[model samples]
Target: MKKKTFNVLLLSVLLSAFTIACTKDIDFNQIDDFEVTPVIESSLIFLDEPANQFLEDGVEISSVQDSVLVEIFKDAFIKEHLVKAEFVFETTNSINRGIELRIDFLTDSNIQLHSFSFAVEASSTNTPTIFNYTEVFENNTLESLFETGKLLFTLNLKPGPVINENTPGSIKLKSKGIFFLNIDNTL
Candidate 1:
């Protein structure tokens, strides 16, 4: 009787151990990425002619003015699995000319959600400069915007304090941007 009882106990222990070990399998999550490029004409900045200021009918003024509104990719970029997002601005003409650049994310009502600025000095002589700006929306900022389809990108160019008042040099800044996004298993 003693031997039989010992065998039964040993079998039970082995079965429990095997079951527990099998249950501890590894869990993997999926990731998705979205990227896009926005258009902005640096040559059009600080145009002195009136003809350059006005746009044709049915044309969007955001393209020619000091600010440009960017359209976001709503279908692919969701908030559920968003791990990180970044905007990288690169240009070869980032000369230190006291030029101020403002980038903002806006709502449908033209409300500012988030913004950042970059300044170039006057002393800089056509050196390649890049601005890698990262913005993480707080309190479901991105989630709600995505739901309402009100997300927008606004870029503004301003003259810095050190800029010459009499003859401010024309800043032809051609810039490009890449959006880096990390999404979770929702891919």
Candidate 2:
């Protein structure tokens, strides 16, 4: 009986102490000043083409073209919050021929918004040659990036040794895009 009475007394004291602790009133208006900056990284393209793909009917193709539809820019929320964008491309060439890569950002009507190009050196041996390129969009360029609806990639083969279906190497490309956004919540 005595132990049970002591436990009840201790519980009552702890509850009273917790109730007496003071807390300041929260200001809900502070939420209006909240802002957040977020960075998003996404894979944009990956191409691994064998040398044979560049040959058609025993003739070496001058260029290979590909395009991807970009739908993220269609979002109004993303457009309003986007502040900057960066695109990074890495190419590995094991073929014995130099290549030029051209990237174009286009609108829904097929109008070109932005374009850039970079060259990758030819590999002398079976060893691969690597090239890295980065394109940053800010200030005026950010607006052009937001208007992009499609991305076109063109790979132009440079004059070199003849490439046949028996060619021993391939060309690999990896690319990504980083987007920076600033959002503000105000009531």
Candidate 1 whole-model C-alpha lDDT, 0 to 1: 0.43
- Cα error, residue 30 of model 2, in Å, equals 2.6
- Against the correct fold, how does model 2 do in TM-score? 0.86
Error of 1 at 52 (Å): 12
Q: Lowest-lDDT window of 10 residues in candidate 2? A: 178-187
Candidates in order, TM-scores: namely: 0.40, 0.86
Whole-model lDDT for model 2 versus the true structure?
Answer: 0.92
| Highest-scoring model, TM-score | 2
lDDT agreement with native, every candidate: 0.43, 0.92
Model 1, span 1-187: residue lDDT tens: 9999999999999999988775655445312334333322222122232212223453313233245444453555444434334444432224343345565556556676666666544435444444333344434565543543233333333333332223223444444432334443334
Candidate 1 lDDT score at position 102: 63
